[model samples]
Target chain A: MTESGHSSGGGMTARLVAAPRVRRGARQKVGDIVLSVVLIVLSLFMIVPLVWLITTSVTTRAEAFQLPPRWIPTPPTLANYAEINSLIPIGRMALNSLIVSVLATAGALLTSTLAAYAFSRIRFRGGNTLFSVLLAALMVPVQLTVIPLFILMRTLGLVDNLAAVWLPATVNVFGIFFLRQYFASIPRDLDEAARIDGAGHLRILFQIMLPLAMPALSALTIFLFEATWNNYFWPSIFLQSNEQMTLPVGLVQLQGAVGGGPAVVVFAAITAVVLPVLILFLIFQRSFVESIASTGLKA
Target chain B: MSSAPVAVSTVRRRGIEGRSNLAGWFFVSPAVLLFIVFIAGPFVAAMGLSLFSWDLLTPARFVGMENFTRLFGDATVWLSLRNTFVFAFASVVTHIVIGLALAVAVNRPLHKVVQYVTRSAIFFPFLISWAAVSLLWKYVLDPDFGIASYYLGRIGITPPNWLIDPQWALPALIGIDWWHTIGYTFVILLAGLQTVPGIYHEAAKIDGANAWQRFWHVTLPIMAPTLVFAMIITFIGAFQIFEPMRIITDGGPSDSTRSIVLYLYQQAFESFQVGYASTIALVVFAIVMIVTLLQLRLSRRWMGHD
Candidate 1:
């Protein structure tokens, strides 16, 4: 097959080569080298700003704006980190963010998984109708809903509480739809067999089905955690006191040089907030990427 | 075949139909209850408040359609709409082009490691919050002490004031947005690129096609559907841009960077014009719906890769 196909396309290769055949391999090699060099240089450029942020975070105030731009600090101290740590209660902000993110993830998992099971496994009146409405909700930008959500939260007296942020985010339309698709793709035979053995619907979902769907569940957990961790807008509006601020909002207030102190202090605050998210991504980076790709394909 | 056994099972299933009804509701009640309390409930309340003017401190008066009328006449609202469109358009275009180019360059069949590293590096920006991103750019764009200015001075060209200057502020915001958002589009597009079969390229080569021609005919058509999805998502994200503009510019330099969301926030929360803010939100909603519908419609014409 190779020989036949090569002979059939032999004339095409000749026409494509504007130069001698002996140089073709050499040209392709040169192309690879040049491409590699270009990619390396571009990647470095892209990374330089982030590296600068890390460096500046550790640098003292005086050295932060030093002439000729000190690529590395002379005596890299944790003073800036220490200063920011005390100046703004970074711990409190982190705690607020943690509580909100943790609860939101749990709430999302419980609600979305159940909805997914209902949409995928159960055949009931208005089931498809409900699922379609959920899909349409994905198109409605959350901004459009924020105004109304704020009013409702205020009426419920949930303002300034973590529940204000957690409750609303739990209603993620995309999360429900995502898990629904994943569940639908699971073999129905397992579910049917469980049913024949006198298992109830909830029992089937929690026992046999949930165990088998761990991959999708784990992926959804990571997605939910990251999204909730990084949320800024609602938290900003809902929580009033500095004591209740999430990391994103707290980081904003923590910024700006303090009493002629070094800019590194602000950088330290930024670094502290970013560290957990960076670590989270690194740990689950493969599953995170795979889940995102799978969702795209499923859509 | 197993027709008789299947029939027996069907008869058993019919007998259990009444029992299954309560189970379905039991299984779905938690999600349904949360959706009602959180989403459906809020949506109804928001609409109700939009019809009345109230600041939580004061009693609301029912003023039907008055808020929307005021919203339509507000010039700032109109300006914000224009800024939002320009912001979303410029950023989405640059993101798609840069993302596609990087994906193709790094996706060479021989260098899997290189592809993985480059993609991870690009995707790093996405993990960082926009609040941090705004801080990073603030220093980089600072006119007096920013590295950008110093580099320009070394090259004998005066640096443009990036953030403070009204004329450059929007472009500057766009640049920062692209730097942050290109990663998202890159990942989505790369996923799409991985699905395009290499067999098509070899066939095109056999048919005497040049490099550029092969990309145009084989790679692009196949990636069109993913591209549409990416662009629409990018458009939605761009339209809702708030944090970067709010944190970096604060709608400064004569409010040139005031986005629709920012404006709506000011109207609803800052000015305590709850009714007007809701009207503006409804307008924003209308625009999003129109754009999304247009995207869905247009995807039919050019987005097919099958």
Candidate 2:
């Protein structure tokens, strides 16, 4: 994968190789300048909405509604944040989201890694057929399964519970498929050596393969965490009560409850809902990009 | 003594192999169980439910093909389908064009800081949840004091009541969807661009191919598989777009912006037409499957991968 371009030397080598003909006279320079300017503008276009969201969240109600629109909050206040908390249990919703995302991530990682190991390493009966079935499930959108799953959950008396949100998500076929590919890339010699050393299958997986596949695991962890954290559709359906709702679901209820109220408060709630994930992305942007790239490119 | 020992070791090896097989099943049991209970079970149940007429409260009467037939005659179903197709089509074209262009621009050798910042800035919106994005756009497109209307009015072009106007609502939702998702398409294309082996471009240049020719002949062919992948996912996603419409407009302005999923939601929840909704779900499944297969089949012609 060209993800290997993470090295500075690779970039320099590419530049050095392309320097002569690509550095054609003033025309190329102008084109480069234009491309740079366009990219900068597009970048600003992307970032400005987020900037507006943060600014609006802090701005007073009067300032937020101003005709010209203030780019920055004058007399910025955390009052809206307080107001949002009062309107809905933002803290409680955040906690629910945190709990659900954490559990879902852990569950997905465990299931996917185990399944992937079985699929990749173990020569079990019907393994290919089972993997093919799992891959087929990948193409089936969750929305198509939502109605029956809802009924199933109802029958199981799991409605309005966090389990409804995380349970279905626990078996991520993409994660299984991804990790299987990663695990398959590891040489068979290690596992053979582990086996010769009297290491059991579980020991071989845990002690040898799992450690080598840490990058892939970390990537899957970030993907699963972000996906679960941001999931709104299933949570919206399953969690009806205010206390049970995740942040995304709660935000919608907040919008309804505070209809025609101060817009800043809503913005504050939006900011509150979005900030944690944004910070997570900023920290783990590389892994996020790498995982997405690997998935798309490999597929 | 050697034959006896060899036979004993062979038996032990067979025992170990059998144990490993059992271990494999044990390892995969949790995932398989969940897949059965959640995915495969629901899919089969949906098929069965679609064959019956039932609201949650009533005893379901078997109606065979009645729901499917009704779907054919249903005006709102057609309307929502049309809306979904329009949204999906527009999304695919715009995301591809804009994403590819952005990827090309960014693929140029730029300052490391500039590259990182640009990538992060563009991809940031994708990291945010659809709920947050939908609300943020709603605020931005608010008719009364929205910055969008404010800015447009300044330029002597009055923006329509975006979410309220039927004519504007779907377009507004499409624009919001683009804003939220273009980052994903961009990143994918950028990754594809990185894998395009600079030598191809250099080779093209040596053959006296101009920039446009090089891109058309070399860059595009290499990027075709990634492009198709992006397109298929974007279409699937766009067809299932419910969040923006649900949040921003509530599928309002006379249901002009209602996607098929939103319509299905309305049918199942609001109208309590679970059987009919299941039928719709099946339709969605079929459409996604057919479209995906069609794309896959057609892609072989243009895609370099055999």
Candidate 3:
């Protein structure tokens, strides 16, 4: 009887695990199929407009206006792309955007990393209070500061220059916060060992800490680059001259110049302006999603 | 000899501490300087500028409390504030509900390729700049020769002139904003959902809890903090909505869709009422701070984090 009971107990344990699997399999199959269908519909909602934009870019002015709008361009052509360049130096504006965004990203990464290292590793007087004040700065809207900043830029003769668009943005609170958290996570013994080897604070930060924090730095770089690249409001306000205008501000002028003309040309201009950043995003999609997700969770 | 060595070590320690302190200051100086010059200085200047009237062309004159009083009486300010609140509220609600639903759907047991493709498709629009999004929608929503109109007509419904019709303009902008931004919220919620341990669901299932009960009891509580974070950020962003209105409608056929930021821009640039615009900016700042603080306080009660 004892042997039979032991055999029954073993069977009970096996059934406990396997029973749920069999039940869940039947239920989850239906759920998964329904969920997949819903997700496909939602994905289409997101993708169709972009596909439409691309199709519209290649369509002729007359075909663009046809009812039951064409899903695919009929005899797709590159004429609209050519027309955009002639109307407003689209290539020059894209280059301007690239230069400003790259410089701003570099400057921000430098300043934020240095400051984050100091804040995370060094125990100076009032450091916590100072860091709190920096955090508070995040809550202040850019709108409140724009008027005075614009005036200050004008006084410094930086208006209508790319400096005006990027200077104020070079010091970012979010970047500092993100990197500081990363620095704090690093083990203290590493810094202690470096100190014993007679490494200076700058040496330690540059050589030891930075290499270990490359993941965080790359994520921050992508975030800052995307933000600076897509920046519109600040560039619009700071840049007045057509020659100094970035892609976003230039696109607005192109829109005004087109004046309800061929939809295809405007579509072409939009596509050209957005394609570089879109490509960058696709390449670094993991970094983009990870950084944003972590920021949200940590905040 | 022992005393001598101890004293030498003491002096060396002091020297190292002092040198490191100096280095700390040096490292942080650039960020501190930029912050003071750009952020802190402008904030104070905005406060001062609101008390004096000056067009960039002329000498400033002090007019204490006049801008504030003028803001109080300005009907356009009231109108813009009301519209902003409506847009912001609708944005927060729709984004949370739809984003959570999307996250739940994607979090289910589905094929790996479908999961990745769905996520990429949903998030693609978010990477594009607001300027491009605003323009793209303008073409799609055009009353004549627009695809939206064409499709709606095919389904036997007349599409209103979206950007022109006062009643539909704000709703149209809201819809465009959802298309532009819901991906961000989805990704955030998806991350949150992934963090909820599967053991809790298994236990709940053993207790014979149904799917809805498990979600309501186990999933919601575990995801509370993330939901709160997403909600607050979404509210903050929605309140600052400017690009769509400025680009598509230009504050509309009847001033129905003018956001507070657009109003401030018009006052400062078009009318040259720099002082009054600063006052408006201050009001916007105060409202955002108070609402954020209030949300934090309220979340504690429901978030179950003592």
Candidate 4:
């Protein structure tokens, strides 16, 4: 639990904490092979649902529901893709998701980065107490807040509007906590050196701290974006109509429709919702994994 | 020290402090504003609302403790609580068990590319939204025309109506949850496993300790903190289970799958009892806070003994 092996926000931390691999005996090699076989098969269990989703989305109805489901459609069609929007107006829902995720992530990052700087670098009265208050806010489940938040949203006339989804998201308590940890880990001399050169706190945070804190910042961005994109409950509650819903909410509505609104089309809708995240995962795989792995250190 | 210089330095320090005090509040004001408006305000509202009888359509009427008194006797509340506990217990046990196994299995002298591929494949499912995952599972568990059914049938075991049957619904949700979230726990455990110094295992091996003994003695102790952390997080997340129940079963098959949060939502939105729902929400906060505090205390005790 000590912060000796790896601190919070450094590029080389992962390398430093990684234990060197020891040479294995002949018996262990055989065990490794067996473990590999078992894990790869298990990994297939993890992936097959997604693969089936894409395959089902691309297939015709006949190919989709046939006994012993087809891995690939005989003539994979773009036909279901066309029908998804018509059936559920999923394209509009996706736009709503995109707007909410982007706005919220950007707002969270900006505000949290600023607050984190103040917390880590500046001396102020009641700073520790305020930090504790935010930490307390972090633990109360979002469900607990919804009863009142629903009222607030209604009072603001933001129900059925994307603004409601993204507004409260603008201030992420976890993001502040995370960025503060990362900011605190950096050596004070680096920012002090900037201060000696006549730079203010803003300049120091942007020029020195932020660039160095990119490792944690990007990780936080990925998570904030993912959380915003994937959220189902509040959006489902606040959003009244289909057009205002996020993609996940829309997908549920689609499923609840007649006969689950054609299996092929629903899968197509699901795929569209998952596509952005899947692409982000592929692109930022290392940072994403490292960020998640580093979360253990919080223990 | 000279008194003049000491006084000068004190003045300088006070000046700097004055400036930083302003700057600090300035930087953090946005966050403070948002927190008060969104989180703190809502929490206070929740407390006040819990004491009143209000539906969204009507002005709140003072009815202190009525909702709370009713909470103790509601059959659905107790049923959902039981189901949630069972689900959380199962989730925590399974996640830690499988997560540790997977991490230990992969902490080996595998090729770099092989390691990356294996890790990515297992972890990929964690990235997909729960909503998408829930919908995709319906297809996978479809009785007549699903791959699971097709495969299980071939093996001479019938796959039950997963999301429908009351007996199978909760278990099926647990299975799907494991598939979706175990990767996160696996990654945490994996990181913990990798941080264990190679020298300890080598020393254990030199003492003629077998793999199990080395793991049970050395690795398990080293990874205990990560295990505890993952267990608490997984349990908390599982306890708040909503998406799958809302989308998949709608808390059906005799209300067997209705989670506490889902039930709260039903009361608040469907039944339009905001006061009762706020009380339920308080119950959730209390339970989570109590459990988290209990976990921290127990972990402290256990770690102290260790």
Cα lDDT computed for each candidate against the true fold:
0.78, 0.85, 0.86, 0.86
Across A1-299, the per-residue lDDT of candidate 4 in tens digits comes to 23433455445755454322222445567877887788778878778888888888899876677777788688999888888877788878889999999999999999999999999999998888999899878679989898899998989899999988999999999889899998989999988988999999999999999999998888888888878988988898999898898987888877764245477888888888887778878898988788777644553
* C-alpha lDDT (0 to 100) for residue B239 of candidate 4: 95
The list of candidate 3 runs beyond 4 A from truth reads A1-24, A257-259, B1-14, B295-306
Q: Interface RMSD in Å per candidate, to 1 decimal?
A: 1.9, 1.4, 1.3, 1.3
Model 1: number of clashes?
1
Where is model 1 chain A poorest over a 10-residue stretch in terms of lDDT? A14-23
TM-score of 4: 0.93
Q: Per-residue CA lDDT of candidate 2, range B1-306, in tens? A: 769999999999999788877888998999999989889998888899999998888798999999999999999999999999999999999999989988998898776766888899888888888888988888788878677888789999978998888998998888989988898899899988998999989898879899899989999988887888899989988988888878778788998998999999888877888899999988889888887777778677676463
Tell me how each candidate scores on DockQ against the true complex: 0.52, 0.59, 0.66, 0.59
DockQ metric, candidate 3: 0.66
Clashes of each: 1, 0, 0, 0
Question: Residue by residue across A151-264, what tens digits does model 1's lDDT show?
Answer: 777878878878888877775677788888788888999989988998888899999778988988887787788788888887878887788888888888855553246567
Question: Which residue runs does candidate 1 get wrong by more than 4 Å?
Answer: A1-22, A256-262, A296-299, B1-15, B110-113, B298-306
lDDT of 3 by residue, B1-306 (tens): 769999999999888788777877898999999999999899999999999898989999999999999999999999999999999999999999989888988888789878988998988788888889998888788767677887888899999988889999999999999999988898899999999999999999879898889989999998887888788889889888888888788898799999999999888877888888899999989988887777678777776562
**Candidate 2 chain A: minimum summed lDDT over ten consecutive residues — where?**
A1-10
